[model samples]
Target: MVKIYGHPFAAFYWKVLIALHERNVPFEFLMLDADHPQHGEAVARLSPTGQFPVLIDADHVVIESAAIIEYLDLHHGHAPPMVPADPRAAIEARQMDGIFDDYVMAPLSRMVFNALRDTDKQDPHTITVAQGTLDKSYA
Candidate 1:
């Protein structure tokens, strides 16, 4: 059985869940939160960065949201692959994924992280830069 270690609120983790559901795959969810210290510790061992959304299939351990999604599609998907089989199409798909991750998600994540920091510890410069990136990406 496949086991996924992640939190529901995390976008990267959520992406993997959506992919699994879309492929009609059955798996176990190991949430990483205060109540699940063991799950977090397991992730700390499985992932280099101790990040969530790590997929454990048999003896294989996969980390990174994009990589995990591709792994699921290649190993478990039935018909059409999540990423196109065609070289050109695949490149385009990956390109867009990168754009979203870099321009949209990264900035949004930075803003959110900053928001979580204490007011005195928060970096206005970082928030401003992230906001600029978001604005440019949206434009």
Candidate 2:
């Protein structure tokens, strides 16, 4: 069985989960807190970057959501038929994924974390910047 070390609230983690689910790949989702001793050591052993959403197979370990999703698509033949048989479409999909990571996920994650810890600690300027990005992203 494959295992995925993930946190449900994590953007990248959920992205990987969605990919796996879309591919109908059977995997165990191991909910992990990056700071926890058990998860930290295991994640480090699996991922050189020590990141979440590490996919562990019986013999091979892979980190990074994009890599994992690509692997699943290659092995499972499970992606939607319209998901780009063309090389350019594949590139577009990857590019859109990167846009989400850089623009949407990153800022939203920071804002959420800051809000969780202390709303006052969140800079108003940063929120304004993120909101502008958000608006642009949706539009």
Candidate 3:
């Protein structure tokens, strides 16, 4: 059985979930939390960076949402392809994916992280820059 280690609220987890749902893949969702017994250790074993949304299929382990999606599309024959078969089209798709991740999600993530920091530790200038980047990306 395929197992995914991640939190439900994380956007990257949602990205993996969307692909799994689209592929109609049956997977066991392991919600990772420091409070949960052994969950943190297990997640660490799967990911060196301790990042969420690690996919485990038997002895194979895959991390990173984009890589997970590509792995699914490649190995799971039943699923619709997430990436194009043609080299040129695939390159374009990956480029666009990076743009969205970097321009859109990156700034939003920075803002969220900033909000989570202690008030005194928070950087108003960083928040302002992130907001401006988000606005520009939207425009």
Candidate 4:
């Protein structure tokens, strides 16, 4: 089975997990503490950036969430792909996905973990800037 090495609550990890889950792919979620010794080895072996959401499929290693998600969509064509097949539709979908990753994903993610830690108070300026970027997502 494919094994994903990552922290459970991490946004990038969750993104890859969600992509696999949405594709109905079978995978083992190996939760890793950032400070763990094996975590460094796990990351160094796969991730160029020493980051989480590193996927181990047998002996092959895959890093970066967008690449992981695209691989899932390509390999598991049984499920409807996130992007439309048409050239324009695929281009637009990719653009929107980028905007979501840039805007909604971060601040909205802060809302999730910060609520648990009681840290990272919401910044109105950040929200306004995010909203402006989101508006461009639809353009």
Candidate 5:
């Protein structure tokens, strides 16, 4: 069975979980929190950036949500691929993915991370910029 190392709160990680559910793929969700030291260690060892949502399948270790999703679609033999099979449709899908990541999620992630920081430690300027980006993206 495939194992995914991630925290439930992570936005990027949620995409992988959604994909797995959509395809009816069975995977173990390895929670990476204070309680799961071993899972955290495994993720730190496998992921290049020590990031969450690392997918381990047999001997293969896949990092990055997009790559992991693509790997699943290709290797898991699911009913319908998350990405379209058609050339033009695939390109458009990929483009939309890039746009969402860069314009929407990037700033949103920045804001979320900033919110997690201590009240005084958080950078107001950064939050302002992120909010501005989000506003533009939404518009």
Candidate 6:
């Protein structure tokens, strides 16, 4: 069984979770919160950057949502490949995925993270810039 390490509310985690569900792949979700028993140690052991949405399959550990999805597509056979089989189509699909992740999710993630910082340390200008980027991407 595959083990997924992440917080439920994390967007990247949801992205990988959705992919796993789409493939009907059964996995154990290891919710990592500050309060969780294995939050500090286990998560750090699995992911070097301390990021969520790490996938563990036996002795193999996969980090990053995009990489996890690709690993799943390669290792687990399911209906409708996450990335198309054709080289050109696959390249386009991956490119679009990168655009969505970078242009859309990246700004949103920065804003959310900034919001979580101490009020005195928060940068309104940064948040505004991120919002503008998001708006432009949406347009």
Best by TM-score: 1
lDDT of 1: 0.87
Sliding window of 10 residues with minimal summed lDDT for model 1 = 76-85
lDDT (C-alpha, whole model) for all candidates: 0.87, 0.79, 0.85, 0.74, 0.87, 0.87
* Per-residue lDDT value at 61 in model 1: 94
Candidate with the larger lDDT of 4 and 6: 6
Clashes of 3: 0
CA lDDT, candidate 4, residue 65: 80
Q: What is the lDDT of residue 97 in candidate 4?
A: 72
Q: How many residue pairs clash in each candidate?
A: 0, 0, 0, 0, 0, 0
Mind giving the per-residue lDDT tens digits that candidate 1 earns over 9-109? Answer: 78788878888988888999998889988888898888999877899999999998899989988999575777788999999989988888899988998
lDDT of 6: 0.87
Which TM-score value belongs to model 6?
Answer: 0.93
As for lDDT, the candidate ahead, 3 or 6, is: 6
> Each model's TM-score?
0.94, 0.83, 0.90, 0.69, 0.94, 0.93
Question: What is candidate 5's TM-score against the reference?
Answer: 0.94
| Model 2, TM vs. native | 0.83
User: Candidate 2, 114: how far from true, in Å?
Assistant: 1.4
**Worst lDDT 10-window in candidate 2:** 75-84
- Over the stretch 39-113, how does candidate 5's per-residue lDDT look in tens digits? 988988898798878999999999988888889999884669988889899899789778777888889889888
Task: Give one digit per residue, the lDDT tens place, for model 6 in 1-139.
Answer: 9989888778899999888999999998887876777755787887888877888899998998999998999897476879888999999989988988998888999999899999999999989999999999899
